[model samples]
Target: MKNLVLGVNDAIYRACIGVAGLAIVIMALIIPWGVFSRYALGQGLGWPEPIAILLMVLFTFVGAAASYRAGAHMAVNALSDRLPPQVQPFLTLFVRLAMAAISLFMLVWGYKLCVATWNQYLSTLTWLRVGLSYAPIPLGGFITLLFVLEQLLYGDQHKRRVVDYECTEDSKEAV
Candidate 1:
């Protein structure tokens, strides 16, 4: 059961990285095309700007989930680090609980927000539903929630090879 869960999470993490990276690459290309079209071609393409914005939203949320799993999310540890060693465990548990709460909020509210706007379509991109753009919110929340559960149950998986490639490379550099 443990291996199965870990394997699934590893795959999910990889998928998140791929999706976020692809979104960034596509957004980069789209923005440049928009600029070129507006200034050089003498006509601004409405689709590119809105499309890029949507891609950005996708990137931010999906990338955040991957970041959390890798233990790369921004955190201020000054206070926690200063606390006595014995209290650190309690603090860690509190932090995890807090994350779970935030994740739940995002999951519930984000889904509601998405449903509320489901009927509306983007002004520039009529084919895409406004609700679809908001999907990453709940998706990210759910993914983060899974990671939180993994942490609480199995402890930090940050040292897992799939998530710690940078550390592996750094060690190679030292050799």
Candidate 2:
């Protein structure tokens, strides 16, 4: 079950990153052509700026999805590391709960924001509605929450442990 969840998470992250990367590439090519058309050909591209901005927004949010799944987000481990050996389990539980709360908050807030803007259209890009702009927040947050839940529920202790050894001379020790 844990493996299946992780597999899904990895698939989502990779797909989002791939799409965002393609968006960036298309944006790069479009902008240069738009510039050339404006300056060299005396006619500006009608939608370059709008397209670029949209692609940039997509890149950031999609990249966030990937980061969350990979556990690459910035975090403070000071408190966890400072706890005594026996208290680590409790601390881990607390941290997971806090993360779950954050994810839920984002999900609710983003949904509200998206709903509020549903009727509005982007000024520069009339082709896009405002709801589309805010959609990524909830989507990314949900994916992040799922990833956190998987970790919280079934994290493997053996895989998480640190091993250290100092060799000592002994009669039975191999050279």
Highest TM-score, which number? 1
Task: Report per-prediction Cα RMSD to one decimal.
Answer: 5.3, 7.6
Cα lDDT listed for each candidate: 0.90, 0.74
After superposition, candidate 1 runs with Cα above 4 Å error: 162-175
Please give, for residues 1-175, the per-residue lDDT of candidate 2 as tens digits. Answer: 5456655656676788797789899899999999999999999877898788878877776776566556576768898889898999998778778877888887889899999999999887787899888887787678667767867876632233222112335633776
User: What's the lDDT for residue 47 in model 2?
Assistant: 83
- In candidate 1 the C-alpha lDDT for residue 158 amounts to 80
> Any idea what lDDT model 2 has?
0.74
Q: Clash pairs of candidate 1?
A: none
- In candidate 1 the C-alpha lDDT for residue 62 amounts to 85
Most accurate candidate by lDDT: 1
Q: What is the lDDT of candidate 1?
A: 0.90
lDDT of 2 at 122: 88
lDDT of candidate 1 at residue 52, scale 0 to 100: 89
State every prediction's TM-score relative to the real structure. 0.91, 0.73
Error of 2 at 124 (Å): 1.9
